[model samples]
Target: MMPKITTNRRKWKADLMNRVQTVDDNDRPATDYTFKRVTYFKPLGVTAQEKALSVQEKAEVVKRINIVMDHTINTKDFGIRIGEQLYNIERIWTDDEKREMELSLSYVD
Candidate 1:
């Protein structure tokens, strides 16, 4: 069974975006991303983890958030934006009942 969502917890909002490719004046290829307001849905949960390696001297952080499922969401054509930061969708998990989905997102600063 899915966990219950409360009204007070529904404070977080995110945008669903689609990537578009375009050519610049110099004939160089570029990406033009457009976004649409999905809804004001709260994250069911959040998990943050960090990983580091000495050889590469690089650190990576991945955050997982769950929200109520929207039928329009698809991994192939859409991304998630919270505030001004854009996140890459690494994975998506939808419940059997299709009530909610968990999104694995990663971004580097």
Candidate 2:
């Protein structure tokens, strides 16, 4: 078995958000989501390239982060929020022992 995950390594905190749409009594459209606490690592900086006007241009940098936590079945249909920025779940991987999981997330508009 692998070594236990130490809490000291997890330095950042993030929230998992699920998008929910509803209608108020007035029939106005509303959209929002709830947040759940999760531990995440620091984001890694990355530059994005976009094709603009038939030319390859450097777009804004998009940071990607990894969230590591105990095994859980509800990883899908959720987005991660760090501070004022929000990141969409890209992928998920679990350890061989199935004791932990790591979620790959990227920034989204």
Candidate 3:
């Protein structure tokens, strides 16, 4: 039998963000609640893109990242934050061994 991989290859730090609703001081609805970290992020890196989008003669940076993390993480319920930039989970794929998950993340704004 092949030896199982035990150590996780992670270098970048990431935070998981969940949406929360709160009332403002004026009794109005507010959505600026602080994000709570669910778990420590695993190995992550920005993937190279084949094409860039040009909006109105202006170039837009398309940031796509690949994240390898624990299999128990539920990315659908929250977003990811890395280096002051927020990213949305575009896709999730599990490895062949089912020990880790690959998260395809896209930068927000």
Candidate 4:
């Protein structure tokens, strides 16, 4: 059985509609983007009445978290930004981290 789709797109979105402005091979409207529904969930958390964590247990969790973060982050990285930008100001993060930056971007009216 085909699942029903809940659509909330522009008027020319679906295939079989006669007034749709443009049609593709599959009969759906030609679009620059695809849409999908996303879902979020909350997990059942630890119940307070079940048990109280000891100080040792709390420290263990912090230690495990740092180990995970150390493994996940890439030490060397580069990135790209697209914009009309200006230049020269600075900020600092950790003792070794620096953010030398500036921007006075403008757009054509």
Best by TM-score: 1
Residue range 2-40, candidate 4, lDDT tens digits? 999954222221111111135789988752222222212
Overall lDDT per candidate, in order of appearance: 0.65, 0.57, 0.56, 0.21
lDDT of 1 by residue, 8-99 (tens): 45567887788677899999997666887665655543433323321133423356667777777775566778888877666677885847
Please provide, for model 3 over 26-88, each residue's C-alpha lDDT reduced to its tens digit, 9 standing for 90 to 100. 999865424766444465444444223223324333443445545545545666777787766
What candidate 4 gets wrong by more than 4 Å, as runs, is 1-39, 49-51, 59-109
Best by lDDT: 1
| Model 1 lowest lDDT segment of ten | 48-57
Candidate order, lDDT descending: 1, 2, 3, 4
Model 3, which residues run further than 4 Å from truth? 1-6, 21-34, 38-75, 96-98
Q: Candidate 2: which pairs clash?
A: none
Write down the lDDT that model 1 would get.
Answer: 0.65
Task: Give per-model CA RMSD.
Answer: 5.6, 6.8, 5.9, 23.6
Using lDDT as the measure, name the better of candidate 1 and candidate 2: 1
Clashing pairs in 3: none
TM-scores, each model vs. reference = 0.66, 0.53, 0.51, 0.13
Give the Cα error of residue 67 in candidate 3, in Å: 5.1
